[model samples]
Structure formats: C-alpha cells, structure tokens
Target: MKKYIFLIILMGFTTMGLAQNSVSGTIKNRNNETISNVEISVSDAVIQTKSNEKGQFEIKNLPIGKWILIFKKDKFEIKSEQVSIGNQEQKILDIILENEEHHIDEILVSSVFNKTQNENVVKIDHINLKQIQNAGAINLSDALATNPGVSVVSTGVSIGKPVIRGLSGNRVLTYAQGIRLENQQFGEEHGLGLNANGQESVEIIKGPASLLYGSDAMGGVLYFNPEKYAANNKTELAVNQVVNSNTQGSNSSVTVKASEEKFKFLVQNNYTTHADYKTPNGETVVNTRFIEKDFKIGTSFATSRYVADFRYNYNDLNLGLPEEEIEDSRFRTPLFPSQKIENHLLSFNQKVFFKNSKLEATAGYVFNDRKELESIDEIALFMKLKTFNYNVRYYLPDFGKFETIIGFQGMNQENRNFGEERLIPNAKIADIGFFGTSQYKFNKNLLQFGVRYDFRNVTIQEFGEFGTEGSFQKLDKNFESINASFGFKTEITEKITTRINVATGFRAPNLSELSSNGVHEGSNRYEIGNPNLKNEQNFQVDLNVDYNAEHFDFFANGFYNNINNYIFISPNGNTIDDNFVYDYLQNNAVLFGGETGIHLHLHEIDWLHMTSSYEIVIGQLNNNSSLPLLPANQWKNNFRANFDVSKNIKNSFIFLQANYTFNQNNISQFETKTNDYLLLSSGIGTDIQMNKSKFNLYLTATNLLNKEYVAHLSRLKADGIYNMGRNIVLGVNFDL
Candidate 1:
C-alpha cells in the first residue's frame, strides 16, 4: 500500500511536468536595431539566443524558472537580465549595444565572453550556460564532448580530462582566477583541477600564450571564469540538482552573490556522490564516486576615473576509481598514480584612466599541490607534485584606438618522489621564467604579438652507489632554453573579422618526466624516471574567421602545432637494478585541428528558434603514430518555441535541445581501441513573480532512455563497465 501511494505521487508529478509551457522575447541593440546575426549566450546559466534582423530575438520553451539571460556579440556591448519564465507573463524585451566607447554599460560577463573590447589578441572559444544546461550531461564530460576541438576520456564516472587538439597531460595548461592551474602534473588518475558548478565562463586559447603566461604551455591554455558581481544592486541565488542517467547518483550546487555601490562579492559551492553507474542493460559496470568543492571571492571599489579590483579563489577535488586497468605500456593504461589534489589562487589589480590609455598594474600568486597515495589499499606510492606562479602587467591606452599591453610573469615548481622497497634517494627539480605580450590596433585592423624566455634547472640528490646511506650524493643537472611567439589580427569588414597567429613555445621537463620514483596508487602504476631529458620546443600557427551580420552568425578557426623534443614514456628494452622499467624520452610531432559554429535566425515567429555548432581535431606523433586520446569529431544543435500567455492570466515557455558526438576514433599508439557513441536528453520548466522576488522551477531528464556506454577514457572497460544511467533533476532559482 505504501509503495502504491508513492507511485501515485510520482505519477502525479510526472503528469503535471509533462504539461509543458513556453516563453519568448526579442533582443535589440541601442541603435534600436534587431542586431540580426549576433550570438547571445549565458554563462553558468541556462538561456541562449540569436537576434534576428531589426535586432529582434527570442527564447521559447524555457522552464518556468529563475534564470539569467546573457547577451553577447563580436563587437558589441555585453548585457545580462534576470527574469522568471513565469506561468502567465509574456515578456517583450530588447538589448541595446553602445558603440566601441570601451566603457561597459552592462553586465560583467566572464573574460572569454567579452563583447565590448575591440578584437586584438587571439580569438577565443567558449562553453556558455545554455550549452551546459541543455546538453543533457549526465556528467561534465558529457557536455565537453560537444566542444569541437576538445575530446574527453573518462575512466567511468570518476576520471576525465580534456584532450585539446590532440594534446593532454602537462602540455595542456589551465587557468582559474587568472592563474595557471597546478593539478594535472600529479598523475592520470586525476581529472582537471576544476569542476563546472560555479564556472561563469570557459575560454580556450588553443595555441601558445606563453608570453602572457609563462612556460609549460606549449600546447594551449584553458580559462575558467566565475561571476564577480550581481546584476544591478540585486542579490542573486540559485540551486541546481542532478541525478545521473546511467548511474543512480545525485549532485547539487548552491550559487550566491551580492553587490553594493561601493563593493561586491559572490560564492558558489557544489557537491555530489554515487554508487556504481549502470548501463542501459541494467548492468553495474564499475563502482565509482567523486566529491568536489569550489569557491571564488571578489572585491572592487569605484570612484570617478579611479577603479581598482581584487579577487581570491580556491578549488578542491577528490576522485576514486573502482576498476581502472593496469597495462604496463599505456599512459593511462598502467595508470601513473591515484591523486587527491587542492588548487589555490590570489589576485589584485589597480587601474587609472587618462583619455589616451588606461594605466594598470597587477600582481598575483597561484599554488598547486598533489600527494600520491598507494592505490592497493594503502601501499606506499612515490610521486608528489606542486606548481607556483606570479604575474604583473601594464596596459597603455590605445595609440589612436590602439592599446599596447606589456606584462611580466614568474613561475616556480617542485616535484618529489621516493622509492619504498628500493630505498632510493629522493629527486628534485626547480624551474623559473619570465615573459611579455603586446597589442597594437589601427582602425578596423589590429596587430597582436608577444615573446617569452624561461630558465629551468634540474638536480638529483644521491643515486645508486654514490652517496652516504641517507644523505650525500649530487648529480645536480641544469639546462636552459628560450621560447617566444607573435601574431596578427584584422577586421576585414563590418561583418567579418580574421586573425592569424604564429608563435614558438616550449615545456621544460618536470619531476615525472626527468625522474619519478615510487609506487603510484590511484593509477596503480609503478613509477620510474630517466635523468637524460631535454627541454621540448613547439612552433604553432593559428587562424580565425568570424562573420557577424543581421541574418547569420558564424565562427571558424584552424591551427597547426609542431613540437621539437616531444617527451613521452614507452617500454624500455633494458632493466634498471634488475627490475623491469620504462623510460621518459623526447621526440618530435605535429598536431592540427579546426572548429566551426553557426547560428541561424529562422523567419521570426512569436513561437520558434534554433542554432547549432561542430568541432574536430587530428594529431600525429613523431613515430607517425596517431596521438593518444585525441577526439575525432563532434556536433551540437538546439531549438526553442514560445507560447503567447498575454491572452491568458499566466504565461509559459517550452525548450528542446539535442546533442551528438561522432566517433572519436583517433587512437594514440598506446591506446588499444575506443568505441564511438551518442546521447539525447530533454526537459520542461516555468516561472512566477511575487513582490520584489522572482521564483522559477523545472524538471529535466538526462539520457532519456538511459543509454549505457563507456566514455572513451574509461579504465574499467575490461570489466564490462558503462557510464551513468537515466537521471531526473529538479531545479529552482530566485533573484531580488
């Protein structure tokens, strides 16, 4: 009788939810123009749109819930509005963009989504809120799979990493709160140093940015930006919950922000836990669980022409793998080590404007540390890693609509490892470097470029047959290398912008590359290192073309990277101390790829809208073998429709979204094989307004049929493992 009662309640809720509703709106620029052909998106949000000609745009089929609307364009101002997709209120609105005056009159979106700034440095790619909310991600990797140039491999539900243009590991640099991330160097068992809960923006610098950000960035860099202020003087808060499609796991997030005339602050926290995720066949593949927490704080003061800003952020991560494989030769196969990592950042800046240019000085430090634990239920594992960074920059107002940016940065890093039974002495390595970047603009055409120089030194304490029992031998090794880069940006026309960038970059050997000793627990691989390694060099070229008009919006980019002295680990034919071991070696390789996105404004109807995007990558190692863990191809599509509620007492909306990822068969030499798969999901929601506060609610189902498949990087595949099962999520948001 109790079970029947619960079922009846569940059925009632399901029936009520299926009674879908919809919402709609129009976006326009200050010229009172429809701003057709412009892209509008929300970050760490749930809404997205494209304005049609006459600068008109709309979103339909939105969950009647509280959500933020973010407006963006290539050369226009950025705007955001808070509103509820209520049960009966029909909303008619337009967005206005001020000319390139440089003064932002609207929302403070993330760094990557900047619209008011003139095109200068590199063209950036983004993963906004609409993408996150509608992509049907049972997990973060599910959404990243939609990005063109990025490929994700997850070791079941707990392990995952982004493969950018065929590059992974240390070659892929990450940025959080404007600082280099330090977690990846720990081991393969670790995922990115960041989670998606509080992220307001994600920017991908697909090529060398070593100038503004010092060494270890030979491949590219990823930037994650969170909200700094609440829209207007209002307070913002929202909670999101999720249940995996294939896994019966649950996750939740709490986001809050407050700002006043003098100062502003915001905070975000997220949590999740799960048992073994299930496949469509109801099979329990692997038992996996993950726990993560992230937060950011910002403070800024404004007075006439003098405005100063400062921010601080902290990120924490812990992942457990149930059945990861232990192949001797593969990178993730043998699994380097299990990792529990913590990342931290502190930033400060001051700026003064003087008609010609704004003078600025910035300073900050970032620290990352990871300690390896034995994966075999508490056995001793060897490797430990950490990275620290510092930076400062000055920007001279545009020399006639142009700005020159000069900056210097410093970095310090250390890697430590000890042998258990081998009783081997510990090894140490130290690195330091400085770099600069500059930009010059002329009318519609802009010139951007930069250069960098880094010095690295490596040392080993005592080796076999060399020093006192516990102390004295030194084979201190030291080497130095110089790295640099340059680029060009041009506005071809009012509707088209193109950029070409060429630069030289490099990554110095870290403790793991030069020498690693100890048992790595998480990844369950015994670690060994080589002392004879050289600094690796890279040369890259990047080209981007963006077209913005009243009817269609498009973006496309191509990139090529050639590396000298590429470092990798492979089986060694010989043995060390009568024990089987592998050595870290360097080689040369080339990587290339491109991504494109398109927005189509259908015949403006009070009831409909649609958009789509795609990305791809290909890479070849020195042996001419395919690079490991590179994504093959990907695509995404979204549609929405609005219902007029003015005729009725209450208003409503309906949204429909679908995403697809083609086969990422691009296998590396070490990878045995990975299969291709696709996923689908949908949801409905609505909103209401009472007093000064707005209330929103919604229900979303992911992996509709509970399809089960292993992400390309799952380590439990041999054990017949699959990812999350079907999941349903309930969400609510409010703003005052």
Candidate 2:
C-alpha cells in the first residue's frame, strides 16, 4: 500500500509541473499549400506533433526551458526555432512548413484521417501501429496487456485471451475487419485465431457493448484491422521471423499484398515449430503442445464509399498435456491429439458522408470450426458454428456535442460431440439483440448512455447409440435479458482528466456449458452435460484518473464487478467408468475483481532513458475465494538507451531494453499459489535500405537471469514448475 501511495504522490507533483506555457504555428508547402505531417518537437524529447492538413498546430506544457522546436518534412529543408518557455508572452512561433517535391525516390503514404477524442466516448489508449512496432512482443494479446484496464493470461502458449476488468470468454467479443469472430461462443479454453504480423491495430473497448454487438459481448469488444491497404497498381510483401529465449525455436511468417482502386487483396502465411520449450529448471512443461504451422488469406474490394472483404484462417498444432498427467494414454497415441482450426468470414461496409448527416452500415458472417479430440477414438467434433452481425450508425456533428449509434444483431451456433456408447448428436443455440448508444458533451463535462436487449435459446439431443434415439432436452430455454451503461468524463484541467463508466450485462448458457458429453484431452478432463442452467448477469463500474505532463504520465483505474449465476463446474461426487474417473458437476456462484497499472519515467540522461510500470489485480468468487486463472499482481520495470553508432552507416543506432515482472499469487479452487520471480530481456534492431527493398534485423534475449517462476495461468501442472529459461532469438524483417 505504501508503494501505491508514494507513486500517487509523486505523480501529483508532476501534474503541478504541467502548467507551463503554449505555442502555436502554421506550416505551409512550397506552393503555398498547407503541408500535413510535418514533424515538430520541442528540445529532442520526441514530444512530436504534426501540422493539420491546413498546416496549423498547437503545443503546450512547457516547463520553463531553453526549448528549440524543429520541424521537418520529407524532401523539405528542416526548420528550427530556439526560444525559452520562461514567461514569454511576446513569442510568435509562426513559420511556413514547406515541401520539397523534387526528391521522389519512392512513394510515401500519409495517414490523413481525422482522429477525434471525445471524453463522453471513454476511448482509452489507441493501440496504434507505431506503439505496436515499438513494443516488441510475440503477439497482440501480450502487446495489449500493457493497457491498464485489460488483463491477459494464457490457457497455454497456444491460447491467450484478454480479460477486461475481470471478465472474459463468454463476456467478451473480438472483432476483425468489422466482423466478430464469434468463436468465444463456446468458452475460455478455446483460443483466438488471429496473427498480429499483418494486423493494423486492435481496439479494446472495455465496457458493456452488447448494445451494438449482442449477447456474446457482455464485457466488451476487441477490433482488429489490416496494417495498410495497398494502393492500386502496387504490391507490398513483408517477411518476419521471431526467436525467444524462453522458447528456443523461432517462428516465421510472410505477408503479400496487391491493391488497386477497385480491388485490394492480401495473403498472409505463418509457420512456427518449436521443440520442447524449457523452464528455468531445464525441464519442459508443455509437451508437443507447441504449434507448427498456421495460415491466413484475406482480400478486400472498395468502390466509392462501399467496401467488401473476405478472409480464411487455418491452424495445425500437435498438442500435449502436462508431464504429470502423461499417464493418460488418451493423449499419447491418437498422435497426441493433433488439433486443427479453420475460420472463414465475409463482410460489407458502406458509408454516406454528406453535409452534417453521416450514415455507416456494416454486416458480416463468421464461422468457427474445430475438430476436438480428433486424434482419439471417442472423437468430440465441434463442427462449423456460424454467427451473423449487423450495425447502423448515424452521426450529426451539427447537433453540437450529441451523437447516437443504434443497431440490431443475431447469432446462431451448433456443436456435436460423439462417443461409442452414445452419439450426443448435436446442440444448437441462438442469440438475438437490439441496442442503442448516445453521447453528449456539456461544458467540460461529458456523458454517454447505452442499452441492450438479448433473447437466447438452446436445445440438445440425448441419443442412446451411434444413431440411437433418446428424448431431446431443452437445456436452456428462451431467456430475455437487458444491459445498460452510463458514464461521465471530466477534464479537470488542460492536462488532467477523470472518467468513470457504470454498466450492467448478462450472458445466457452456451452449447458447451449445456451438452458437452466427452473428454477434452487438452485439458485432460471429461466434461458432461448440464440440463439445468440459468443466465449470468453482472453490474460493473470503473473509475479512472489520468494525468499527463511535460516529463510524466500516469493513470489509475479501479473497477468492481458483481456477477450472479456464475456457471462453474461443481463436484459430481464420484464415478468410475471404463477407466479411472475424476469427479465434477455444474453449479452457480458470484464473482468480483479489478485491475490497475501505474507507469513512471525518470528524466532522460543523454541517450539513456529509464521507465517503470506496475500492474496488480484482485478478485473473488461468491465474494469469498479468488477467481481461478486470474492474473496475479505483477510489475515490469524497463530501461532503454539508444545511441548513434555512426553517420555514414545511415540508419545506424543500437537500443537495449530490459523488463522485469513482479510476483503473482492469487489462486482459486483446485489451484495452487505460485511464487514471484524476476525476468531480464533485451533486444537490438536496425534497418538497411536498398535500391528496391529494405532489410531489418532484430535480435532479442529473454529470461537472461534464468530465474524460475510459473505464471498462475500456465497450463503446466503445479509444484511451481519453471516456465521460462535463458534463450536467444534472431529474425529478419524483409520488405519488397
């Protein structure tokens, strides 16, 4: 607690230092046209801002220093200004930002889209491409975990899903290219099939968003898009390879794109094969569970203001359970349950932006298919499950600070699990919803309201033989539920903001929770069906205070979630079938928790920089014990330094980054507590420009200390099994 208080106090003083001065300027081109994206910064802190398309920009929060503002655009002479921020009211920092159109070595694209920040919308940090490239990580989930309100824990290396506040799986909805994956339609054990290599960005909307998405989105929604759409008559290809110290093997991928005015196409291919990844103890935990190959191909067509897209993703992985459970032959023979994933999506988007009346419409179809336990005799196949979503938005900027979005969505899913004694046949479920969202800004105070209604239905077939007959069971019947949200954001000052959003959401039972009848070899558990199930509802409120200044940035957010009818498996007493059996059943409970992060950066020293970030989470089940699989309180302290190696070397620089994670100790039923440990990781990267292409090299070393520690969510069987060991990775980023 003292650590938290001291950090807060230090941040308060930083906020006080933010009230310094302001500067404004105009940037125009050689032809007297306003030039956009002219990088302008004070001193060399990289506090960068760009001129608007009209070449106008504003800067603030100067802490009384001899500041020199530098403005430079590609092919243009670099502009410079030396002035003091010390009580200078007569300072007129105005200059024309020019453009040098003569040096056209290659095509350069600019991002001209207007970015709007509305306090009423509660838009957290925008995970832009720049941030993604700077924060070297293995995947999107690991990258997004840096955000305060979001938490991520892997079911294994192959499965990592984000938890908002304290909700995930059934409570969350992930979107790509305006389409929802709908695979989380089942449960948390299943992983998302997205690769971040060719991704544009991932937006984490952390609140009750069912008003636009439907029942599957009780917690929030995550949006993913392509990095860049190639222009007509152009082609871009990128190849990436990554190696990590924790996992000795390297993963490689390639993405090729060709686009034109009427049509844009992209093809992405990825392959990763790892041997037994070692832990600090020099032993392997997750067996052949490592993945070998995955592929994804996508294409898009745009005309006027309308766009259409299609995508397909496939995964082939040889999976295995923990060494402790190796006695279970079910996973040894059927070739250790080789798993495959196939996903297909199709969608269309149209926009009408005329006058103050703006209309946007989107519709899409998604299919998530998985062949569970396919390598085993008693195969449990989850066939093609489908989902359909649609939305319509109308914006009226002329209405002042008032905006509204409304839409309707419907989803239907089917699952089948077979066995020799009896074929469970299949289970079918559906969700239909209607919702609305409104935002209003008054003075410095902002407000937003949302509401949603969902109808759920589920049916199961209980057959006796392979094709034998049994009475059909309506496990979960038609259920009606509602979700609502209201929030407020207030800018206490030009540099400080406080925001809070309170919402309620609900989720009806899914197929897996209702009629799963066979063994899940991956989890090494034989799951049964539950005929009696109820809807789970939750009401949560989040409070955040953010402060940004000349040399500091900090935010603290707290959330409380009250959940009821939590569908957790109960004790099925005891049962011995053809093989040694485990006991489990189904029951209901309540849950609550919250997550927060605090980051601080020390003043820079020459080419060196120091920064630290801390994250902690606490939660309970029935308001009693901890929530299983919840990420423990941890912290990452990082130090980086970059230096100019030489001038003739051109793009020459060396950077070193080191990070450490603190202890995590929350454990639930049947789970053990894990001890804390430290990790040291470092990386160096550079790029070499060529005549027609570019080559980049990246080398990273992880677990430098070889410290042994186990993540609370690591799929490895208990006893504090070491999770990572010293390893080095080498990769090349080639662009053609």
Candidate 1 least-lDDT 10 residues: 10-19
Give me candidate 1's TM-score against the actual structure.
0.76
- Evaluated at residue 150, the lDDT of candidate 1 is 71
Give the per-residue Cα lDDT of candidate 1 at 175: 74
TM-score to true structure, per model: 0.76, 0.76
Please state every model's RMSD to the true fold in angstroms: 13.3, 12.4
Question: Candidate 1: lDDT of 446?
Answer: 60
What are the lDDT figures for the candidates, one per model? Answer: 0.58, 0.58
Q: Model 2: residues >4 Å from true position, as ranges?
A: 1-120, 128-140, 146-151, 184-189, 231-234, 244-248, 259-263, 292-335, 373-382, 394-398, 417-425, 465-476, 517-520, 525-529, 578-609, 642-665
How many residue pairs of model 2 clash at the backbone?
Answer: 6
TM-score attained by model 2: 0.76
